[model samples]
Target: MRDLYEVLQIGREASAEEIKKAYRKLARRFHPDVNPHDPEAERKFREIQEAYAVLSDDDKRSQYDRFGTVDEGESAARQAHARWAGGRSRVNVSFGGFGGFPDLGDLFGDLFRGGGPVSQAPETPAEAAVELDFVDAMRGTAVVVALRREVECEACRGSGHTSEKVCGRCRGSGRLIHTDRVRVRIPAGVADGDRVRAAVRTTPGGEVAVAVKVRPHPFFERRGDDIHTTVPISFAEAYLGAEIEVGTIWGPVRAKIPPGTQSGQRFRLRGKGVRSVRTGIPGDHFYAVQIAVPRVVTPGGRDLVRRVGELYGVDPRSGLPLGLT
Candidate 1:
């Protein structure tokens, strides 16, 4: 794995603004929508997001700086505990160190041996992340996710015994490391940050949690049920109303642009957006109409545009407040 700073293309001393700017630039360039069909681009994009997630947070960044990796604190703490338990404490440590201090090693011996925690505090299930394409997320799809989890021993069925005898395979321990490949069904209209729980006997005491990450669409964005996009039209097309084909998740549909439509004007197509998961009622598809002016116009075209401007003779921004910069 690449270092977080290297993944984000920033120096260790980079400012927060610089880090954010780098992330945005990289995200835009390598976004799946921008580089479709390129697995390398998609991988880089995921890496960029991961880097930003760590560097964007103060606590995570500090942890990363102190340790080589973000999740090393727990392992480090355990190692320190082992050293103290052996009476070879290189670093000063104290956690209810009164008499002879509880034997953290023996207390957590079960945890180290995969026997599971002894505390009443519910064990936190191991978490894994799965990424899905934008379309796959919109239309429900099944994906196979591989996870390493703690599971009940098959021979003992988590009872640690069989016929009043300790199971030889598990040696009376009902839990063991299990690598599970599970097919998860993603629901339609599932947005980013959504989690789909798949119950598995990974741990004898707990389950493994999987987080779903949806890749961002190139041209479309969803808000609630509405799908938004920006479609550019020629100057003449904006002046003279025309029916233009707009792309939607289902397919392409024709949308009519009214005459004299201004730049930045938004048009809505009813019932053309995403379908609601609850009521099944589809939302509206909204497209902002942006006028595309020709950079290099012919002499005749320039003359015609000048004439049209003179004929209209109206300042569109006349209603603006006075002394506006």
Candidate 2:
């Protein structure tokens, strides 16, 4: 695996904006259209796109930085930490009682059937990102995504050979561009920027990994599994409690506004929010009350307001620092 930072010529401390700028600059320079005759430049352009894909996403970038690879998800982080700790805290091994550990060379030979290291074939699985709507993410849904990936050529059986001459289909390259359709399922309660990996099955090839991306909701904001939203209420509704319908991911639910409810007061609807990915328990939905005052009033409304003000006879601005000359 290539170091993403090295590929982009960026430091680890590079900001997101800086990474994007570098990617754009290099992409344009190495784009196939610009370097029409250079096949190597086209390959480099693909590599750049792959690097930016990993570095541009926050979650993926964190995973890559900590584990040096994003393919294993959280397990990569744990494995990296274990390796680091093993290096820092070395322990003496007691192999005397366990028939003495086999030699490293022999163990690798047994594993690989030879003295050489085991190498991954070009049919290694691929990863592609798929974006989904917020509502679709809230409720689990399946989508078929079209993926452009490299697959071993069938003409030469991935050898790029046909009786000594290069395979015309792949042009001496063992791989060919293939379009794959894979169904990826987005689990319930998946937040924006969260990734879900689904395997893509192919004939004579390794499985492909699909990464799911949930789009941001317009009105609803998610905190863990809980949903937060603001509900606008009129002055009358805030002063005098009323039952109003509130929109939820599940649907509309009626909520009672308590008398004397003030602006910014939050109300929670239990079991009405997103479901937990691990526990499958639904979280509560919290709605903040936003009291909206009337910008313009009718003659009758103005008269009623004036009468109410006269009856109250209390100065709302009494605590203010401003002075009336």
Q: Cα RMSD to native, each candidate?
A: 17.1, 19.1
Query: Could you give candidate 1's per-residue lDDT for residues 1-325 as a string of tens digits?
Result: 5788998888999988899778765654455543445688767876776677677778877888888677853344344335435552421222212122222222222322233444464555455567888898889788777777677899889888899999887888888776778766766865554445444565434444445667889998875466888999998889899999999887999889988998999989899887855346787888999998889889999899888887576796687988857
Q: Which candidate number has the best TM-score? A: 2
- Point out the worst 10-residue segment of candidate 1 by lDDT: 91-100
Tens-place lDDT digits, model 2, residues 65-89: 8888888543543443354345433
Candidate 1 overall lDDT versus native: 0.67
| Candidate 2 regions with alpha-carbon error over 4 angstroms | 1-125, 146-149, 158-166, 201-209, 310-325
The C-alpha TM-scores of every prediction are 0.53, 0.54
lDDT for model 2: 0.67
